[model samples]
Target chain A: MSFSSTDTYIVSNALQLAVDAAVALEKPLLLKGEPGTGKTRLAQELARSMDTELLHWSIKSTTKAQQGLYEYDAVSRLRDSQLGSDKVHDIANYIKPGKLWQAFTAKQRPVLLIDEVDKADIEFPNDLLHELDQMAFHVYETGETVTAQQRPIVIITSNNEKALPDAFLRRCFFHFIEFPDEQTLRQIIEVHYPNIQQQLVTEALDLFVQIRELPRLKKKPSTSELLDWLKLLLLDPPKPGQLREWMSDEQRQSLYGALLKHEEDFPQLRYLRQG
Target chain B: MFIGLLQLLKRYGVAVSITELLDLLAAVNKGLAGYSIESFYYLARTILVKDEGLFDRFDQAFYAYLQALDEVDISERIPNEWLSDPLVRQLGQLDEEVLKQYESLEQLLEQFKQRLEEQQERHQGGSKWIGTGGTSPFGAYGYHPGGIRLGQASNRQFSASKVLDKRQFADLDRDAPLQQRGFQVALRKLRAFARSGAATELDLDATIKATGKQGGLLDLQWRPERHNATNVLILFDVGGSMDSYIEQVEQLFSAASDEFKNLQTFYFHNCVYEAVWPSAARRGEVAIPTGDLVQRFGSDYKLIFVGDATMGPYEILYPGGSVEHWNEEPGAEWLNRLTHHFSKAVWLNPQPQQRWRYYPSINIIQELMQERMFPLTLNGIEQAIEKL
Candidate 1:
């Protein structure tokens, strides 16, 4: 069971090996990288390629580890009991299943994506360590151990917001996804915009890579930003000129909104040559 | 089991444990790496090394182990009987890096002793003697990280172990270019969450009690959402010696803005004399007096001071010792005043922690801050946050 690049998503050689090892070892693959290296998109592509379910649990600052397992709606149950509703009798009705539960009981082995794991509290990963290792969690209310019928492939992404706990890191097969190079970037562009002219992509990518390499950029434009910039470029394409001369002020500076995310970087545009 | 490789990794301070080695063995048993050493290398890396920061060390260790195996000469080989023992094979290699470490250490200590004998007063520049910003391999601010750095006790026993233990990766990465991401991550630990925002979340416990008291009638309750209520007051020492740390201080400034909602920053020179300005642009203008600042921010705010803290002892002790203007009170008085108001206060010194004791001004301020001065690194920030 090897993961290959899909029509939409591209997997580098290193990432492929990491995913394979994690899947084989039955360990969660902890992915870390810059914001837009497509760490979240890997799980989506993997599920699509495998013809399986993709269970995405998007984490937030307020998110708790308990929410991933299950949430008991005691307030709803109490309200139903007050109204004398028949739903109050069954406690299981109020025990709403979370992303983990759904993944656990799925007929087919799913790809469970715990996106932005670092956004939550520091103790979040530590709380889920046992469940992740055992592939089971005990429901105190239901008095039942919810064990995974088929262990799903888990992929967790972190924006490097906080340093993860060591014990949690020890259990994971870690892989850092670096920004794709020119060759890979070109391939990514081709896959996304099949009808786009090759010359235009080559020219745009050359300028993009140069812009990225410039020092003191607060936020380097990633692949997603490039795609957006390209999309905007496609609608009203820049006029054809010499390789360096083609990208004049009117063509580049006017589209600064799509490329340069920060106001400080607008001044950095002056450092770039027309070529 | 690659016991030799594991030992080599540990010797290089990679911190590879038995559990990680077992994980590597498990991967090998599952035929993850068939016949290719490259596959095995990747497999071992993915299993053993847990951080990207240690990648450079592991890369060197892994190659060194492989080279040791290949470079085993028949002439230098140990007896056939002892060769079978992994520990014997590992020790028999006699790594060149180990020899180089020992050689450099001896050379460093010998030179350091000679320099100490020649030096008299505190030296700053020039290549010779124990000083700063020179090609000298004996003291602080020298480009060499592996040099023997003697703090105040140059006559104390010069340990070769301390000199050999210095690996340049961590220091190099932090010193090459300052990143705000590291500061932001460190500052995140100083969180004090309080329910301060609008009442968006449902107060379930209160609702249930309210409903029960109302004769089984349903009554809903609402409460404010939790927000980070950590108020931070940062005083940055600008100009002179602090110019070297401007990049780091500025990065911290930006990161602080991103992390805290109630952050107040002020600029001071050398030390906080009587008043601190609001910004570095208009430094001559005093925005707020140091006395009023104590009452304005209150004790609830966590006070942070960013500076190199390298100045004359008189500047902190005497009233007329300020470089810019004559003052009624010394800078030490202002620091005491601030710390008295804000119980949770910490001074972040950009100067390396090892060199802190050499500066008398730093010692005076440290005593004034009650030993709350911390180095402005990730580990230092974590410790500071814990104290706060």
Candidate 2:
């Protein structure tokens, strides 16, 4: 009923269609994109739009699926047993409900964001297949089963580190967040800084694209980086003519750190920088 | 329609299963795409393809399906003689009923194939090549900037504007030069992980066990983290025949540097003989001898030879056959000694696999390497890694 683009988040038609399909089919949406392409932000925006609670499961290399479902604090339990505490009698007291368990038992439908899912081991996605499929997990400690009251919207983000198992991927609606084109990127800039001059926006975007397209650039500036550069530009506004001069001659430029993240990329930037 | 699209996708080597088909059908039934070709393309792609690497294949298949779907209807509407009428295409300019005249579909296709090559040459030379809306017999082969020039869709207003006009996977296309990311991903699969470093990482399991036994006292244990101890030595073919593949070999070299902690690189021209130099940059320095190279790196190091493998058979089999230097021993003997020393040895030929049979040197090298020769492509590298 509402527009896909809100005050901040701007969704493309293709992405909106993908979202709709995933939502209608009641399946987990697996999002793959380059770093800083707003994979995690998509989950937050979805939660905001749906007015649902968000449960984030930020995975690391050593993070196990068991931790996402529930974790038993054995150290605390052993200490409690030594102290002869009454809390030791009930094993549930030591059981800490994890992100998945919290999402499952949420009062309203919630958004479960598995941020950087690929950072975990290759078999990590396979381990959660059954639980994600049924939206229910078995707690062995208390012999209790936690089931979802309302099916939560599951969104998984991957940095494309490792190929996911086919079995896990088969159950998901996949969407690759393509780097935005000039028009969409312009819209994004407008959303961030509506009062900024149109000429400055055009020139900056041109320079940004030029820097990105420099041959074999080690690291390209991302959307957030562009916003940061723009913010700095707004603070110390460069004259239209000086901006052009400084942009071409790298030594004269003051705010290149915000755009060029890698030192290795500067050699090419200097060679390819346009007047 | 979905079955047709699926068949096309499968033909393009994108693995789309029955589950994906059902998912697509469900999305369609729910009216998520709202019956628009553009929306349906996105919906179908999202439902079917999981990996971004396969997105190129998916886009190709989908585009083919859309074009083929419209082609049938458009062809029926146009006069039969309009296309089947054979005329000689003089590069971009068409000559009317002159020179080579052919009417049968086979002969027409043969002519088109010949023109296709000429068109490629013209396109590469300058930007003034004939494209869509051209009077040439093969107007479809004319440049379209967006994609490979298909039939004149602009002539007649088509019912569906091709939703995906751009080749999304042009960078990932197997025929194109390999990118650094592709090389890194392939090299990642070749890794043989071994824990061989300082035991600085805390062993949590052992710590917890010891702490339990120590009775309320915290105990910490340290163990080594899994380190990539796999050593790699790449012998690159440079100068003469390998000058064209400099960019590709450099990408592979960079990727190898990022992936393997223990890596050694050497540059040889055409074939490895008595000596190979470390890098082109330090070529003024003394070249490392083949025997010294064998002694320097361990047997566990994976030996990869990157070349076109299209040199004269004499260069490999006979002594003093190297183009620049007269080798004391034949290149074959050195290759054999190196292969014997390093159990994991492979020859990566940048030349297409189909052309390998034409090059007798490649066959000889393959036989020597025990058929561990692979084409330098995404799939080829992965298969080579598996063999490693």
Candidate 3:
């Protein structure tokens, strides 16, 4: 069969190939893209299609590799020990299994998503090298090695916040979700809003394309933003030339807030309007 | 077949492990990757190719390996001579009948499609064939209302909607232009201090002092927060008008790399479009969204924009002014966003201060920077550092 799996995410041929390759290799698929490019949604869709449980690990600035493996509740254990509780006798009772640990211990192969891995410190990816490579980690406190029942399909996403270490990069397959081309964007919009008027979609798309090409806007409207704008447009449809001529300057500038995310971008809409 | 392909990829500098190779084979056997050549290529690349940076090298290897194994060469996939330039033969004048027939864009496109199939040999300055510098419906540097350009270096005319080029940012020479000592002297002015962060290391002094006050009792103390570390965000403009300043800019970049511990560098061409790349070669394939970048780097980052600030006024004032891509927001909007986020910011221009008045874009940038623009000279560097 062709690589394009029947999914609502509308995976392009290139993306489909990348997915197939990652699946075939049993390596983690490393996705790098701008915000609102559907990196996280792709993982969710892939898991749904493959009939696997989704195990998500949303990384934060303070997120550490040890937290992904297993968190030792030493403070809780100490409190329990002082209280003379039965749970205080065993360290394993207080061990909270992390996302990776849970994925590894699952009976079936799970889709483990490490979302926004770049949010963590530079050393975060490197820290996961051992466990990701070996597919097992020793619970030193419990003296038990937690090994994978089946190799879980891993999907890692990044917003390109930080450059991942070369050592960490070498273990995974990489794919970049580029800004969707016109045709792809059209298809995406259609998928999300099936019954929307064709004229509105066309106008909004054209206006979006024009706004994105504005020379001075800091934050260009992304795919998600485009969808949101389209939803807004559907509420009160603009006249045929309303985007260019009909709407008042204030109204036009206020409406531009949907497409241009930055505060600095609002003033620049006047220049774009002149064009 | 898979092993041979892997060997070929290895020869071409695409590192693939034995386990990855095995996985590719397994994928093919299980029908996860289809039987088509296209599917196989993608499968092999996804499994074997680890780094996104090595994608161009992988493509070259894949094309070479495919050509060697099969008698048929897929020239379309590879960057060959056909994609380089139009054949140099000249058919100076436009044929009246041909001109009439190709009056509309649709007619010209139709003829261009026919020419793509019929014309195998390279030709230039011809009305009928797909060649350069002619009234032809196809190829670059030709006079056409709407033509299909196969391969061209720079888009002088805004006629062609499609473009194909294999140039990458990493291929550019990154050697320092200035003397090592000179660079060091210029870079010393940058002040860096680690202040706030999650406490990891133990503060022995604090721990000991606290223990003495507690009558010899044990007191564990974490390291002082270093979260408010001095961070520097460098936006280095490459290509187009900035070509002359490459050497000096490279020196500054080298100096900054050596001097700053918290340096975050990104590469842009002409202007910071919607996104920027770490390397030139990977620019087309990989880019960090400019918006995400603003959100990622905090307000404390010292933003140093390095560029000539010399370009067509359209590039700054109008949409679709960028030479490389049709950027939605003008370059000025992005620059302003960056400046707003980074209170401490400066634009270092390599073009001598004397030439500043000549370029309108320079004036526009200066105004945008609120007169923070400075030259790349030693004196200029000192002034810029002082401001920072």
Query: Which candidate leads the pack in TM-score?
Result: 2
Model 3's CAPRI class?
Answer: acceptable
Q: Model 2, range A98-209, lDDT digits (tens) per residue?
A: 9999998999988999998877777799999999999998999899999998778899999876667899999999998878877788999899899988878888887888
Consecutive 10-residue window with the lowest summed lDDT within model 2 chain A: A245-254
Compute the lDDT of residue B189 as modeled in candidate 2.
77
List candidate 3 segments past 4 Å from native.
A1-7, A246-249, A267-275, B2-19, B51-53, B68-128, B131-223, B226-388
TM-scores, all candidates, are 0.80, 0.82, 0.60
User: Using alpha carbons, what is the TM-score of model 1?
Assistant: 0.80
- Superposed on the true chain A, the predicted chain A of model 3 yields a TM-score of 0.94
Candidate 3, after superposition: displacement of residue B288 in Å? 37
For every model shown, the clashing-pair count is: 1, 1, 27
What does the lDDT come to for candidate 3?
0.72
Distance from true position, residue B382, model 1, in Å?
2.2
After aligning candidate 1 to the native by TM-score, how far in Å is the CA of B189 from where it should be? 1.0
Candidate 2 regions off by >4 Å? A1-3, A83-86, A249-251, A270-275, B64-160, B163-166, B195-222, B354-358
TM-score, chain B, predicted structure 1: 0.69
Per-candidate interface DockQ score: 0.28, 0.39, 0.29
Task: Kindly report which residue pairs in candidate 2 clash with one another.
Answer: B131-B143
**Better structure of 1 and 3 per DockQ:** 3
Candidate 1, B1-388: lDDT as tens digits? 7999998888767777687788788878988787766567667778777766666566557756865644222212112221121110111223323323424654765765666666665655444656543334554333333444332111112222232112322332332334788888789888878998789898989988998899778888899998889999999988899888887888899999999999999888888888889988645574678887877877999999988889899999999989888989988888888898899999999998889888988999899989999888877887788889
Better of 1 and 2 by DockQ: 2
Model 3 Cα lDDT, one tens digit per residue, A1-275? 23353535677666887877677567889997667888999889888887779999999977999999998865566457556789878888999999999999998888999999977777799999999998999999989999999889899998764557777877887787767766678889888888877776776677677778786454678898888877877677777655555334556556667777888776766655442
